[model samples]
Target: MQEAEDLFPAPAPAPAPAPAPTPARDHSAAGHRARLRERLLTGGPDALADYELLEFLLFAGSSRADTKPAAKALIARFGSFAAVLEANPLAVQEVKGVGEAGAAALKSVSLAARRMAKGKVKGQPVLASWQALLDYLAIDMANLNRERVRVLYLNTQNRLILDEIVHDGTIDEGAIYPREVIHKALDIGASALLLVHNHPSGSPEPSRADIAITKKIMEAGRNLGITVHDHVIIGADGHVSLRAKGLI
Candidate 1:
């Protein structure tokens, strides 16, 4: 019986293996977003770079997505934060990941900026806050791809009455008639007017055509006892006042 038991000895128990180490959690993206938020709260918008500011804006629209790439791409495509905000919604949507919602988000900023600027100039003498008026024009028209002619009608006090777009796409005599401007001024009871247009070429230098048209409009307004305050040309680089240059 002892010999038979020895032949069928129990097998040794299998050795236990050591447990594998758990991988570290990757929180890098979350950590970055937190840091950016902290910096913005502490330092205000001036502390963040353009792309960083754009990233923050994108985060509001897409909380879970990584927004750095989209922000950088927008800035690169549109040239600046202001430009991106002012861009057409369709143009903005051309960028990957910037769908309708993202484009709308950017457009909302532009609309807000315009409203704020208009508030500063409306019901106040535009010349009294010259810088603010210029800023409003820059924000509204500087980045436009086509030429636009706007008329700023003013009351006797030089306070803005009506801001109207007279012509868009091109500013030829056929499109911008002196008679039409005079009729509008009369219709609005504007005692004075400011003629404004944008040059998409980034240069505010007035063409001969621009000078000639301004003279025509000025003459028309003068005959009716309406003051032609200035003919301001907006460009991407900066703005130019025909009055300042003695062109008027």
Candidate 2:
């Protein structure tokens, strides 16, 4: 009671202003990711646009930077979201800032999409779902670094009985042997067959070797009473069908 100033002792020096609350750093990137995740979960499939879906995919790898530009750039470069996902890992690396993380993200997404498509076609007559089969083949074979010749062996019902890799190397006529193709089909007890190969150059247009191999396979299939359904050449850009072009 001797003095009011002495009693309070200057309010204890104002408690050092509470240390300014540590300035509350921003976490916009993390916040954005959380929001995107919520959209995917609550809104279902229609919740995301093409780019938004791509953005969500990139978030797995590029969580720190803005993903909008990367997503847009990918679609712009590849001409579509599907094409970007189907692109080769090296091809995807061509994009700026698309390092190991980005390429891995795209590759994983493409592989997951392929698995989903394969599940849809499983235990079903593949011939009836020709478009689905082509889409699956296109996504799987496009953008490979090396050529891979795969054969889908079918039974009498045109169902996929076996899928085998007959040859993997450069896609040329001499690289594949008609006898080997015939023997593999026979070994698998396949009554019908569809041939597929990839072009690393991204041009599905058939080369002389492509045509020759198709002819040899078709001839062998004929002699063995097996149907040669189609020869599909997949490239980075698009796919070519021998049956559609009347080459088979």
Candidate 3:
């Protein structure tokens, strides 16, 4: 009772500390995109730099973070921005933080590019747009990890009529059958054909088996009265045309 004031003294709780603000990392990705969009709007075609163009392509995949490091890393690893876009999905994913989403974005861009290239020559003679055809083929084939042999069945007008994936396996000479190829061509009503395949080792150089297979396909097409336009071998490095190389 004598020390009532002391006994009833109120205790004070400590005040809560203020939260520290999160430091802003350079919004490099957003800034980069903004600059590119501005340039594209202000200037006409060819306004953006190659790296900036690549950066725009990459922005779709890395919406949350800076893509400059990733794009730079890709160009650095693959030697060029074109090479980066040409890299296979697995190879593209090997870069840090380039997960499935990034892979899909890159592949979608490739597919779209191919569609546009094909559209340029659609309903027209294929020979007239050979560059477009080569571009479509190179972009589509350069990234494959496995060996795949495909046939482009064409009509008499040399317009694309059908694209068939005939065999997917190791590139041994025996895997491709001229008889089977001819039969498929007949079934598809193709008057002409283009042979295409990929090399997993990143070398477009034709193996003995590759050359033999090309010869067999050429012979079969000839006997069936179907023209063989080209035999193209694709690899990560690039593509080689057997007909162009005098191998067919």
Best by lDDT: 1
Against the correct fold, how does model 1 do in TM-score? 0.85
Q: Write the per-residue lDDT of candidate 2 for residues 1-248, one digit (tens) a residue.
A: 57977776754444455555575645687777777788999996689888778888877777588787778888888877877887777887788767678889888988898998887777778889988887788777776557888888898888998877777786442256778877877888889888888887889999877888889888887988988888888887888998899876
* Residue 1 displacement (Å), model 2: 62
lDDT of 1 by residue, 10-56 (tens): 89999998899897765777877887888999996588899888787
Which regions of candidate 1 deviate over 4 angstroms? Answer: 1-27, 170-174
Pick out the ten consecutive residues of candidate 1 with the lowest summed lDDT: 168-177
**Quality of model 1 by C-alpha lDDT:** 0.87
lDDT of 3 by residue, 83-195 (tens): 67767789888987676778788778777887887687667677778887777777666665567888888899898888778777754422567888788889888899888
**Error of model 1, residue 47, in angstroms:** 0.9
Error of 2 at 236 (Å): 3.6
For model 2, the run of ten residues with the poorest summed lDDT: 11-20
The best candidate by TM-score is 1
Q: Rank the candidates by lDDT, best first.
A: 1, 2, 3
Q: What's each prediction's TM-score?
A: 0.85, 0.68, 0.70
- What's the residue-level lDDT of 5 in candidate 1? 61
